[model samples]
Target: MKNSIFFTALLATTISLASCHNSNAKPVISNEIASIEKTSVDGNTKIQVALLLDTSNSMDGLIEQAKSRLWNIVNTLTTLKYNGKTPDIEISLYEYGNDGLSAEANYIRQVTPLTTDLDLISEKLFTLRTNGGSEYCGAVIQDATKQLSWGKDNDNMKLIYVCGNEAFNQGGINYKEAISDALKNDIYVNTIFCGNQQDGINSYWKDGADYGKGKYFNIDSNRAIHYIVTPYDVQITTCNERINNTYINYGSHGYEKKQKQAEQDRNAGSVSSANYAERTVSKSKAAYKNDSWDLVDKMKDDEKAIDKLKKEELPEELKNKSKEEIKVFVAKKSKEREAIQKEISELAKKRQDYIDTEAKKTKTQDDLGNAISTSIVSLAKVKGYSVEK
Candidate 1:
């Protein structure tokens, strides 16, 4: 039973890619209202997860595992529904214990705010690098708790996952106080200790979770991730290509964002065939929205979006086209994307079944991905969220 649970969590987070240099620290919440407003009215709920990772000298393996398993975790989140309504999902990221960060900031940096831009998340996650530094678990947790725009809705699943190998109470900020504040804001803090279970317990990692009313997991941060290639993987990749052709870039950064989508695809593919397929499956889900760049996704929210776009902002292919022509083009592509997504969705189900079967035969291995996602699924169930089996 335990192995099955671990395998499921591994499946949830096991697809990630790409990297860039770290950005300057911005403590402010990027888009609080905008993020909440993006939530579908029917559901009016959100799944907000904040990842606090220790990027110290010894955590190269931990970062690699996170990069490899991003999409799997995203796919897992998409399966959850509250009151039978699909909830909007947002993830925030934080890096702590890096010498590259400002010491005045307690060696902690908020990499990204809670937002629906999964591509941005992927891009930023890749930028993280390990450096020898202090690991202030309490300080990082406190920043994530106070800074991110967490929803007050009782239905929202607001969770903070802090992963590291250091002592949980090493920081100046009292972990107990930080956890108390998080609970007051209705956020559950889960801890992932990247070492022996007893070591973690002795170091107060378990205590951190207990105080915040969340799960505590111990994992081997350096474990190699195993991927199972499914028969449907090829079909999913083909579907992904078809779907990419359906997006029409518009706005100032449209073309750049479009290129990023493809770049991320390449990054995922570079990891492994299974990771590539996992990303394709994530793209097929409703949560993989790209309204900020893709015309087809934009038109869903704003019918007059074409009229609002300046010609200079339009992609080269659409620059010469009239509003009516563009509208027709977008509409056509939207339908094509819908059809392709449906096909991928169907194939993804079969692919997952294949993986589940294969996973049952192998001994489960613990890693950062499994430790984090296992708790996500369990907590989702407790919070009245149902997985779409």
Candidate 2:
């Protein structure tokens, strides 16, 4: 009877082990299925782009080319894939030379502010017309830098394409300063050098782009005019081919090793710990919790450090003894604060001046557009056709 009981216990243990293994295997399969679903959902990233166009009299053909190719550019961007992920691109257009007066006012008018609606962008592009003026690239950059809302979020990539036939260094504002500001705001400027100019002219634009952390394209005038419907194809295709070749040359084994290392870094525990610490510190500083005293302590320490560094410092007897001494210290501190406040006030005034200048320029541009539309209507009337505003 003892031998039969022991044999029954061993049989039950073996069945239980088999059932546990089957349950674990089912979960592994479910996790794999869920991962596949996630991969499909996270495939498309978004891009924000701006086109700074030159509407100078010399760019009539360039404008025509751009209109013809606008749809093609949108289609190409929509279809682009990097590492099996598509990029949804949004575009904005701004035309220089559209404003007939002061060159400073001829900057970007939001045309479209980063929207995925390609149809609307295309329609606006088609409406752009050429006018006569000197291209002030610095003004355009300054205008774009200040007016356009760019880089509001980290995931979006902002690009500016400055297309013009003239030299980009003509305006009073420094090109390097404009470019630096754009880079600070995370806006990349690409140059499309057009017209019958030497390669040296292209170099100037290239330098400006370098300052802006952008790429430069030297497009021959003839090519720009003739290849209107697909101005970017040759360059885009070449870039894509080079990228593919580089990836293939690196071999799958090498790529996998690099990818695994990246994954490990992303998942490391130290990163999570640092993020938690930051959150805790932020929460602890909330004023409603009566925690502002900690900030006051920091300020006191800062003031003590400054006092310790002073040369020919006031003797402790003089410092602590009289109301006159306390008054002098308080007055000195007040003066220092006043100086800082004055500097801030000056900066605010400068910013306001810039805004006022831009506002005046915008009014001029509006008037120019209205005048052009009116002139077109007049011409149509002379040709015996009814024109509608």
Show pairs that collide, candidate 1. Answer: 12-72, 12-73, 13-69, 13-73, 14-69, 15-68, 15-69, 16-68, 19-126
lDDT of 2 at 170: 70
User: Where does candidate 1 have its weakest 10-residue lDDT segment?
Assistant: 1-10
TM-score of each: 0.90, 0.43
CA-lDDT, candidates in order: 0.82, 0.43
| lDDT string, candidate 1, 117-176, tens digits | 887778767767777788888888888887777888999999999999999998688899
Question: Lowest summed lDDT over 10 consecutive residues: which window, candidate 2?
Answer: 1-10
Best model number under lDDT? 1
- Candidate 2 on 99-183: residue-level lDDT in tens? 4333324422334444443433444555565556656777666666665545455444566777776777876667787778788
